[model samples]
Target: MASEESLEESKKKVYRKEQALKRTAESLEDDEEIELPRKRYYRQRAHSNPFSDHELIYPAKPEDMKWSMLYGGSNEAPTVADVGCGFGGLLVSLSPALPKERILGIEIRVQVTQYVLDRIHALRKQNQGKEVDYTNIACLRGNAMKFLPNFFGKGQLKKVFFCFPDPHFKLRKHKARIISPTLLSEYAYCLRPGGIVYTITDVKDLHDWMRSHLEAHPLFERLSSEEEESDECVKIMTTATEEGKKVARNGGSKYIACFRRTENPK
Candidate 1:
């Protein structure tokens, strides 16, 4: 027969085990309430073609893009695109600046894209009766480098912004940079003649790389400092992006380069 102290110890062990099991069951039940599927957090490799990933968010073609869903019967396609629009500060600022123009923000991360979507929805609801409505702005999860032409027809856009894009610091990963000679041709295809492509970054090397590539590209012409300063959008591009604001807080220098899509060679 066990002593009274031993019996008490056994009872305490059983009680603690029971409590632990109960807590686990309750935790599982709580998890069941979250029905949304988990999104994949990483891509194994950069997509060479946009259409290869059937599950990635995208319209089949420019006509099927459904712009009216965002702008409510506005037939005009989005004239501005904020590529790699992390946290969507630039898009929000531009929405009010160009109330009549439709703008799209392209982000690859699912959670970040969803956050921007929610932010835009909230802004629209909040400003329903206000003079400045936010229905002109929208966010899409996409690989802009691959699928840009899929969403916009040839020469559909007037302005394309690459605000503080990923530097891809490694020499081997440089192709992943948003600005490249090959990508510039695609950008030129989507931008109307004389359309502006605005690029800003705190990384001086990346800035020089982008400027050099755009300068060498046959379809792009570098914008003069006077021309860059004259445009209202340039000011917003510098101060309105989340990355830009962060750089400002850290006292980092910002480099800006703008290019115009020249008309096709005669």
Candidate 2:
């Protein structure tokens, strides 16, 4: 038999989900306005196996993607990517920060992606006709590590972010980590020379692992501490992620490592 506490928690979960469905409906149909999605209602497990197969939508190639559909009639392709953009905290923060550049957040989870999509829709509706209408940021459901090249042309992106990614602490799981040699080469293909990759995490081990991999990759060069402090995207990512804020509240350490994609060798 379940305890009263357990029953109460289950009831709350059902109620919260219903509320989410109602809010989603309002955001879809209403012209005037709608409230932002509460993250609690969109909860999911923190870790997803990047290796798993899931039904996902992606373009065969960069040019085949219908950018205008996501950007609301704008033909401009996204120049920034928030890989593994959990709940889209960075995407919302980066939207107005870089208003002219389109930003895309890719997440693997279904419910979490829906929350971000609805959140962006609500924000866009709220700011309709305003000077900064959030037409610059969008969220999509896909595996960033696998399909980045499928969605972005070579040298098309100027920046990519990996914020507090799954640490994958086990030795066997290192391949699942987002910043590996092969993936870095793929990232280099998508980013123009001099483009940046920003990474922040509360886990020291994962941070070091990512740093080492990027340093070893010929196509990447780590930014100096001075250079890191001066970069606006670096600043945004430090506090713009929900995980970053959680780490701060608990007085945990944050490790940030940024790298520049070098120009192709002759």
Candidate 3:
């Protein structure tokens, strides 16, 4: 059993480590911009919040989280988080599928983030007293890589999605790639035992890279092809994601992998 003093020290360590990540990530912001290919994209909705007198189902701290209350009933609702959630596609879609408090959408882009916020607000206004309640989806404009630990405690998040993350194709720019050993550690840290990390990309090379890293990760167990196929929850790479749809329309084949977080090594 961990002593009180040991637990306090652990919390302090977690805070310090998070700060270190922020400092190191600062370097990524200095890269020069280039005229990138203008991929076909959709426009974002305007900004507005529609919730009126909404109460927080759980306290700000993850330690204060109550799973039973968060899910309203005996059904185990997945506290799903869409990391690198761009334009709120997956977040908004999954919101109606589950309880409002259980779905969180996190994105870094300020403009798109505000757009999603407005879109949800519009949704809420449109669905007043309806079965499709939009309050289940909330968008936060912040870096997912750093804010992940701040919002969630160890073993709290159930499903984490990294749908079509920036590949950062160059070898020299691999660190900028979203999937890495360090990032995977943070993903594993947030996930409860048996929680899964799902990733999809149209880039074949990036797909292989993600598979290699996740498979080699100590905290993750690679799901067998048969297991992945059998699990309805872990469905195949789909056009559900905005980027996935774009890639699919372009005749690109999506590659996907799912890894379950096993128990901490003794």
Each prediction's number of clashing residue pairs: 0, 0, 1
Report the C-alpha displacement of residue 91, candidate 2, in angstroms: 0.7
Greater-TM-score candidate between 2 and 3: 2
Q: Which ten residues in a row have the lowest lDDT in candidate 2?
A: 15-24
> lDDT scores for all predictions?
0.80, 0.89, 0.67
User: lDDT tens digits, residues 1-266, model 1?
Assistant: 46986776676556545434544564465432211211122212322333346368678889888777766766668989999887789999999899888899988766567657656765665576688878888988889888888899999898999998878888988978888888888999999999999999999999999999999999999999999999899999999987899899999999999999999999
lDDT for model 1 comes to 0.80
TM-score, candidate number 2: 0.90
TM-score of model 3 vs. true structure? 0.69
Rate residue 64 of model 2 by lDDT: 93
lDDT of 1 at 266: 91
From the highest lDDT down, the ranking of the candidates is 2, 1, 3
Worst 10 residues of 1 by lDDT: 34-43
Task: Show model 3 residue runs off by greater than 4 Å.
Answer: 1-78, 230-237
Per-residue lDDT tens digits of candidate 3, residues 1-266? 56986776676556545444543554684332212111122233322121222222223555544444423344343477887677767776677555544776776655566556556655655565788766666666656555567667888788888888887778987776778899899989889999989888888999999999999999999889998778654453365677877887898888879999999989
